[model samples]
Target: MALSEREQQVLRDLESQLHQEDPGLADTMDSRTTGPLRLSPRHIGAGVALVLVGMSLVVGGVVVRNSVISILLGVVGFGMAVWGVTLALTRVEAGGGPGSSRRPSRRSSFMDRQSQRWDRRRGSQG
Candidate 1:
């Protein structure tokens, strides 16, 4: 349900107060985005390279005669493929970019708040 004008105004006031009191927290909260994952070209390139190398290794493993060597190669190849997939699927942060340095304390505090909320929810459920 949509908020009424009065509720909206109150929310705005609260947000303004939050910004004034803790600008870092406000900024971090505002920077959060939802929806589709955005992948960078660099990530795509690296992930693809790893995946290709992995595929080649897997193929080589299948062709090899020795069971021990084949098994090792196959395991490594599977690991590399999974890593590549994970890297490729990872979302890039939009607002700050990867290079922008944020206060460590702010992040930890936000995480702590989320953890507390999760704990509270679980406690209520159980």
Candidate 2:
């Protein structure tokens, strides 16, 4: 059987309260969010671009028959490629800000009513 009108109303009221409390909580937890942890092909492409540029430099050095310059370009190009790829693929944690139950942060943990005691002690020393 369908839910009674009262049951539906209660659900709606609870939803309203929850949304008002944290408007984006639903969006954050959406499985479709995919987090910010993965790298896209575009990131890899950029790194490869760096490598190509470095390879071109090496080619130029070759035309001049300069082994030292070729080596330098190769090193620079390889470094750029590595750095670009590294930067593109980092992920940060997802927290439900404020009242979302993630628990206290390292900084916030030590900043509670204990501050009052510390303040009183400091005041006495002053």
Best by lDDT: 1
CA lDDT, every prediction?
0.83, 0.65
TM-score winner: 1
**Alpha-carbon TM-score of each model against the true structure:** 0.55, 0.33
Q: What local lDDT does model 1 show for residue 38?
A: 71
Instruction: Give me candidate 1's TM-score against the actual structure.
Output: 0.55
For residues 1-126, write the lDDT of model 1, one tens digit per residue: 999999999999999999999999988788763423477777778888899889888999999999999999999998898888888777775433365547545787899999999999999999
Which residue pairs come into collision in candidate 2? none
Worst 10 residues of 2 by lDDT: 90-99
Give one digit per residue, the lDDT tens place, for model 2 in 1-126. 999999999988987887788878855654446544444555567666766675666566567557787777767766765676674563333433226454656446667657988999999999
Q: How far does residue 93 in candidate 2 sit from its true spot (Å)?
A: 7.5
Clashing pairs in 1: none
